[model samples]
Target: MSLASLSEAIEQDPVVTRELLHEVARRSGFTVAPRHEAAYLLGLRSSYAIAKQVDLLPDYVDPRLSIVPTLGGSRKYSKPEPDRNGLSAWCHFLNLQAVKTETRLLENRSIALKDTIAVGYIPQTLGTLPHFISSKTEYPHSQIDATVVRRLLLAGATLKGTSICENFSLSPMSYTSIFGPVHNPWQRGFNSGGSSSGSAALVALRAARKAGIKGLDDLGPDVELAIGGDQAGSIRVPAAYCGITA
Candidate 1:
């Protein structure tokens, strides 16, 4: 749509207009004196007009190609449950129900994804600094799976859920995220090294369950595999800290 059309739509919302004006004034250091109010409004309008035009620009992609071509068929999944411990291991537990396919290589295996990786229809945060469950202004769900995720599904891995990660997958420790720190699986107050902290924790939990450890009954079934991203020591650190094989 044109700038004028967008501006007209915006002007219809009196509350929005007032809020925008207040924000503009605050950000401008309140330098817009009464004598310059008209000029300030005009400038704000022009800026908004330009922003609207920019927003309308189409995002072009080659229609002839796909990032990862789908396999002959799609695999089904079961709904995933959140971690019981305050490990903050998961961002969102997905609900996908599917029967196992016997012919696939990874048939019956369950997998948890790091939040940095995209999963179709699930929400991804990559551990945003100031995290919110959803964004009002953006598309609500991921439209496609990451290539790794798609490959896993094709090989018959069941996507159980998405795990938490360091903010933007940059931190070496898990403490600096909106979901809070991922605790060491063995020690409650100890740090779980990031940004693959959750993945390691989940694996450790699964191992604990397999070992018939008491007091870990709430951790659900054993996860056969976990997918995590690494830069520096994200994957290895957490794995060592949690006493699990990465």
Candidate 2:
């Protein structure tokens, strides 16, 4: 390309061009002839060019929706009221299972997903306040179910809902969610534990239920298992704190 064209491209992608050029300069301190400088530099722009439409997601995502897409979720699934969610363990509530599933191994078992996993038409709070508090114009939600979510539903597991997680699933502590802290089932006000704190908390509470343990009866509906997004000590730490396996 001409020098004028190269200059124009760098202007359009100033940040990327500058960073890449800086790195190149730092690594290769050797000097080059001025006549070949423009040609040498032109190659670097390939990484940032907008060559074509970038929508690469699957054209057709199978319907792993909230029973009905338009209505957030079916009547059977819903957001838990404040009183019902005293433990602050759930992001939302639902009873999703494949109607004509091939397997029934997990039948009657209730599971919760960490809010980070995608569940079509359900609000993906990520335990942060986007539309949940500030922006009513749009509520952050997903339009397709993650692979594991689909598999679980197909396996006849009754999905209880998405559980609240550390904000953006980053922190290794339970108190980071925007809504509130997830209380320990064994003792309220105590730590429930990490990024997957809600998931572990719910499952631990449910485990305690069958063992004849008491004190966590009304926190929310019981969950037998949870699909957590573990990055750091999200899963294991919470499990350790709650005296259960993740």
Candidate 3:
């Protein structure tokens, strides 16, 4: 039944409401205080508790089950490597984005000791770099790429502000200067688009399936977009290189 209808029914029956809250608490993995009454207000509280509880599962365990594409990258080749190494790098970045986003979300709720996995090197690199979580991450012993991503994502969501993911580019020389160059997937002669080179290539090959563009909007039939365009070669460059329309 719809939540509204269920709520009305709950308000009308005290005995039923008490029983229901007891049952819900047991099933929802929460400990209800003895002093807490099983009233409509408590029931409403339980609903959100249930949501947050369930939300933790997918964030921790399931990479495929995502409401949002929390990661991005490209599909071009830079140097010779084994078995499309650049492509793999791209996939790692995408995977970590989702993981990081989830992590951020969880931490914002102050859920203690939530497990986070780093998507790939990015999380690890960032952890080692100057960041807030790194200090709490035990100075290199406790950092997991996937875990860090999940933690970061969870944190990013709770701040009462616009949530946005933007596109930025860096050339081969530039990227390498920042975070070493990635190996190529195809041939050595080909150039994986720089900046998000690895991620773009992965999305094109279906190795990574995530919307590069993300924004909050209240619309029916949720938007499923893979990439966004801003300036020259922001998204369209990857889209065209990958042979995708959007």
Candidate 4:
């Protein structure tokens, strides 16, 4: 590629450029001497040129290609809105309008998903940093859905919302998240076990409704099922704490 083209690409993505520069400087213990600055820019230009040429190599492959077929139907996804509940169990609230399917196994079943799973037009925080959230114009919409989400849609599940999780699914206590602490359903002061805390809480709330308990949240819907990740005791611990079967 021409140097001008390379510069344009870098300029278009200042966020990526900043990160790349920081990483390179950190790893190399770079210092900005006047002579060295000129040499550094020249090296970066050369590297960009080489990378541009490498893109033409036949062996290279696009990493974002997916093997799964797209789900067909006139499905509608709502824009993400905030949760009013102090439970802090949700990251984004989206109601997906259901499409009629010949096979309706999970028809009318309200489901919530962990935020780590991608949903088109929904902000995916993964219960962590804001920087992880995609820019509004990054793409037309989410290009692909997570495999589990796709399967749920195919099975005629209504995706009610995306639930919160511990930041990067690292915490067991659910306290160290960017969304703030997730509280236990049974008690306000107690912690909801994580990282599947939100999923467990949603399920527990639905279960409570079935037991004739009322007025949990005016805005909250009855979540029949929740898709959560289980590395270590993420799913099991929260499920146990919330008195729900995982």
TM-score of 1: 0.62
lDDT of 1: 0.67
Best TM-score among the predictions, by candidate number: 2
- lDDT by residue (1-246, candidate 3, tens digit) is 567755565455445456666687789898667677545446665565556446666436355322333435421112223342432232221212232443343333211111122222222222113243455532233223243333445555321111111112334211331234422233323444434443344344432223332221111011112322234563455445545453
Q: On residues 1-246, what C-alpha lDDT tens digit does candidate 4 reach at each position?
A: 676876666446334454465577878897556556555655665576567668887773234322233244433444334446557787666666434443589888999998777775556776766656544533234545666776777678878888888988988887877878887766666877899888888888778767776556653554899989997999998898888998
Specify the poorest-scoring 10-residue window by lDDT in model 2.
66-75
RMSD of each: 7.8, 5.5, 19.3, 7.9
lDDT of 3: 0.35
- For residues 1-246, could you state the per-residue lDDT of candidate 1 as single tens digits? 765776675555344364567687799787556677656666666666666677888875443222333333443333344545455676666433333333487776888888878676556777774335454643245556667776676677766787878877888887876678877656567887888878888788777667776776665443667888877988988888888888
Give all TM-scores, in the order shown: 0.62, 0.76, 0.28, 0.64
Candidates arranged by TM-score, highest first: 2, 4, 1, 3
- Candidate 2 lDDT over 53-125, as tens digits, reads 1243346655553332222235245778988887889888987777666689888889999998887767777
State the displacement of the C-alpha of residue 135, model 4, in Å, after optimal TM-score superposition.
8.5
What is the RMSD, in Å, between candidate 4 and the native fold over all Cα? 7.9
Give me the displacement of residue 10 in model 4, in angstroms: 26
Which residue pairs come into collision in candidate 4? none
The CA lDDT of each predicted structure is 0.67, 0.76, 0.35, 0.71
Q: Which ranges in model 3 have alpha carbons more than 4 Å from their true place?
A: 1-88, 91-168, 172-179, 182-188, 207-231
